[model samples]
Target: MQDEGISRARFLAAGLAGAAGALLPAGSAAAKERWGLSYRGVCYEVTDGETAETGWNATRMRTDIRAIKDRLHADSVSVFGDGAGRLKATATEAAERGLHVWLQPRLADRPPHEILDHLAETGRHAERLRRQGARVHLSVGCEFVLFVPGIVPGADAVERIRNLMSGNYDPQQMMRRLTAFIAQAAKVGRSVFHGPLTYGAAEGDEVDWRLFDLVSVNYYSYFQDPARHVRELRKYQRRHKPVVVSEFGSCTYKGAPQKGGMGWDVVDYDKPKPEIKGHLVRSERTQAAYLTGLLDVFEAMGLYAAMTYNFVTPDAPHRRDPRYDLDMAGYSIVKTIWGTENDPTSHWHWQPKEAFHALARHYARPHRRLDPA
Candidate 1:
C-alpha cells in the first residue's frame, strides 16, 4: 500500500508541472509597454487671491516656465489653483505652448457630491483643451488626507486626525467618491490622475488603483531617508503601475541640532534662526545625488515619470515666514548659487551654490539611462 501511494504522488507532481508549462505565455507577453521619463514638469500652486491680483499676466508666470523649459526641454507643467476661471486660463496658455497640464482643483470639507460637481465643471474646461489636442491630466485632489487643523477644526478633528495619521480613512468610501469624479470626467473625454502625499507607504490609501491612468506621489526629502524613498517607489513599481515624484525638496537652513525645522513653521508663522550646519549649504548636492540615484533606480526598474518640487521662487518674504523663508532662501539652486533673487538688489539676493550647477548639469541634458537591476 505504501509503495502504491508514493507512485501515485509522483505521477500527480509531474502532471502539475506539465500543466504550468503549457499555461505560461511566450516571454510573459513582452511587458506590453516600456516606462520612460515624462518630460520634467513644475508644480505651480497659485492661491485664490493671488490669481485674482495677477489676472492674465501670462508673462508673470510664463517667463519662469519658459526659462525652465529652455533649461530642461520640459514639455509638461502641473498647476493647481482654487479659482475655476484662473485654472482654465492657465491651462489654455500652457496648452497653446504645447505643454501638458495637470490641474488640481482645491476641494476641502465639501460633501462628496459637491466635490463631484466641481470636478465636473473643471473637467468641462479641461475637455475644451483636450478637444484642441492638448494633453490635459486632472488630479481629483491634492493631499486630500492631510487635514488642516483649522480648515476642518471641529468635534471631528480627532477622528480626521486619526484617519490621516493612521491611514484610517474608509478605503471604500474614498474610492467611491473618486470613482464618481472619474466617471464624470470621463464623460468629457478627459483623463484623470491622483496625487497622494507620500509620507509613508500607506499614504496611497485614498487612491483606487483601477480608477486612474497613473499613480502619483508627492514626496519631499524633509521627513524620510533616501533609501526608504527608493524602497517605496520599488513597491509601487512591483504593482506594474508607474510612479511620479510629484514633489521633492529639502530644507536649506540647518536648524538646532535636534529640532530640525521644516523650513517653515505653520503655527508660529516665523522663520527659525538659521543654525549654520555643515549639511545645510550642501543640501542641493544632497538633493541632486538623491534625485539622480532615484532616477537611476527608476530607469532600471522600467518606471515612468518624475517631476521635481518646483521651478520658480515663492512670493513670501524672507526672515519672517520660517517655512518658506529658509527653503525659498536656502535650498534653491538658482537662489543659492546664481547670486540672483526675485529682486537682485534686496538682501534676499544670495549667490547660487554648487547644488544649482549640479542640477543644471543633470537636467541640462538627459544623463545615461538608469538601470538599477
Candidate 2:
C-alpha cells in the first residue's frame, strides 16, 4: 500500500538492538534495529477493481508471513493497502509470527486536500491492532505531492505525479500546501492512534519533520549516485527520530534501477488489461544487484529500517509467455504463478526470485540489536 514510514518510541524504549554480529556482513559494526519487507496483499486499491480473480488468500497469509520471517530473516513487515479486513489479517498473521508490522492504509483514488477521514480510519485500525497484542505503527499516507488530488494537477495519481515531475508546477508553493495538509493530518492522527505515526514522502519532496514523529522517506533513488541517497537519508537522520527508508526496490527488468521509484510506471501497462506488454527484458540478477546495493548502504548508514518495495504482487504474476510476464515491471521479490497448483515445489502459487535469496543472506547476519531477546 502507499503508506508512510515507521517510528516507535516503545521499540526504542526497550533498548532493542540486533544480536551481536548480526548488524551487517563482517566488518560492519552499526546496529540496525529494523530490517523489513513490504508485503502487499491483494487490495482493491492496488488492483484497481481487478479482484475477480486476484486477492490474497487468508489461508495462505499466515504461511507467507512465516516465510517472510524464516526465509527473509526480516524482523518487520510493512503491510500495505486500504482493505481494513486484509490489513487486519496480514498484520495479525505477521504479529502471530513474531514480526513487527507497520500497517499502512492506502488512500489512493481519494480526493487530496482531504485526509482527515483517512487518518481517523487509520487510527481506528492501529488502535485495534495494538489492543490485539500486535506491535504496530500506523503510516498515515505516502507521497502526497503526487498522489493527492489538489496537490497536483491531473485526473489520477499517475497523471498528477507525471505533471508534477514535468517541472511546470511551482514546487515551493506546492510544498507549502502539502506540509500544511500533513501537519493537520498529524493532529488528527494523534487524537485516535496513541502510537508511532509517520508519512511516506518521495525523495526531493520537502516534508516538515517537526510535524511527525519519524522522518520517513520513500527513497527509490538508486538511479542517482549512492552518495546522494546517503545525503538525503542523513538529512532525516538529523531530526533525532528514527529515519526509515520507507520504500526502495527494483523491478525484475534490466536497467530498472535507472527508473527508481517509477520503475512500475516506466513501462506501459494498460493496453493488454491485466497482462502487460512491454519492451523491457526480465533480469533477476539486475533486481538482486540493485537490492543488495541498497541493503549495504542502509546497513552502513546505521539507519533505523529499510523496507524493500514489496514482497509479493498477486495481480502481476509470471507467465510462460514472454509477452505475459508482466511481473518484470513489478517490485515483488517473488513472482506469483496463478496455475502452480500442480507444482509441488511451488510455494503457494509463487516462485522466489534471486533478489529474495540475496536479501535473505544480507538479513541472515547475526545482530544483537535488531533481534534482542
Q: Judged by lDDT, which candidate is best?
A: 2
- Give the Å error, residue 330, model 2: 0.7
- Residue 247 error for model 1, in Å? 2.6
lDDT of 2: 0.66
Q: Candidate 2 regions off by >4 Å?
A: 1-49, 112-114, 131-133, 223-225, 270-278, 340-348, 370-373
Question: What is the per-residue lDDT of model 1 for residues 7-92, given as tens digits with 9 covering 90 to 100?
Answer: 23222323433332333333432132333355455566554422233233455556555655565455567766556776777777
C-alpha RMSD in Å of predicted model 1 compared with the true structure: 12.9
Report the lDDT tens digits of candidate 2 across residue range 250-281: 88877777778778874445554445455667
Per-model TM-score versus the true fold: 0.62, 0.79
How far in Å is the alpha carbon of 140 misplaced in model 1? 1.7
lDDT, each prediction: 0.47, 0.66
Lowest lDDT 10-residue stretch of candidate 2: 1-10
